[model samples]
Target: MTTNTPLIELTAWMRGRLAERVARLIDAGHDPHTGPDLIITPLGTTGEPGTRADRSCDRCGRFVSQGCILYMITVQAAPRVLCVGGLCGACRRLEDGWQA
Candidate 1:
C-alpha cells in the first residue's frame, strides 16, 4: 500500500496543476476544453487503451505505443473543471483503485 503513495501524490499534483491552468483559461474568457481536442479523441468505450502516434503518457512520459493506456483524468480545483488524458498502463496499474 505504501508503494502507491508516490503515484497518488503525483496524480494529485498533476490534477492541481491542470485545474489551475483551466481556471486561468476560463478567467481569461478562453475555452480550455477545446484545446485537448487536437491531442485526444473523445473517451472510448472499447475496454482497451487507444493508440496515438508520437504521443507520450502524460504521467510517465512513455510512448503510447509502449502499452500505455489513455485515461481521461478529471481535474477540479474549484469552480473550474476539465479532463486531461494520457497515462501509461504501468502507472495506472500502480494506482490500483487507490485514486482519490
Candidate 2:
C-alpha cells in the first residue's frame, strides 16, 4: 500500500489549530456582555478609555478604518464594547483565514 504523506499530518494539525481558535471566539461571542480592554478616551466617560474599537484585528492587529467585518465579542460586561475590523473585504478574508 502507498504510504500516507506528511502533508496529511500538517493539514490535520492546521485544521485542529484553527478549530480551537474558532471555538474560543465562539465562546467569547456567546458571552452576553463585555467591558474589558476599554480605554475610556473622553477623560471620564465610558467612551473615554475607548472600546475594542481601539483594539485591532485579531489577525493583523491594526486600526480598522474601512468598515469591514466587525466581530461582536461579548466576553465581558457590556455589549457593543468590542470590534475587530473596519477592514476591506480582502483583509477581512485574510483574517478569516481566506475561508471564513
Per-candidate local distance difference test: 0.46, 0.35
lDDT for residue 64 in candidate 1, whole number 0-100: 60
Q: Which regions in candidate 1 have their CA more than 4 angstroms from the true location?
A: 1-10, 30-54, 66-68, 76-80, 94-100
For each predicted model, how many residue pairs clash, with residues at least 3 apart or on different chains?
A: 0, 15
lDDT tens digits by residue: candidate 2, 1-100 = 1222222222343344344444454576643234343411111112222465443443344544545454432211123222222333544454345665
lDDT of 1 by residue, 1-100 (tens): 0111223444564655565566666787766444433222221122244444335555566666544345535433333233445556665654344433
TM-score of structure candidate 2: 0.25
Candidate 1 TM-score over all chains jointly:
0.43
Leading candidate by lDDT: 1
Show model 2 residue runs off by greater than 4 Å: 1-54, 65-69, 72-88, 95-100
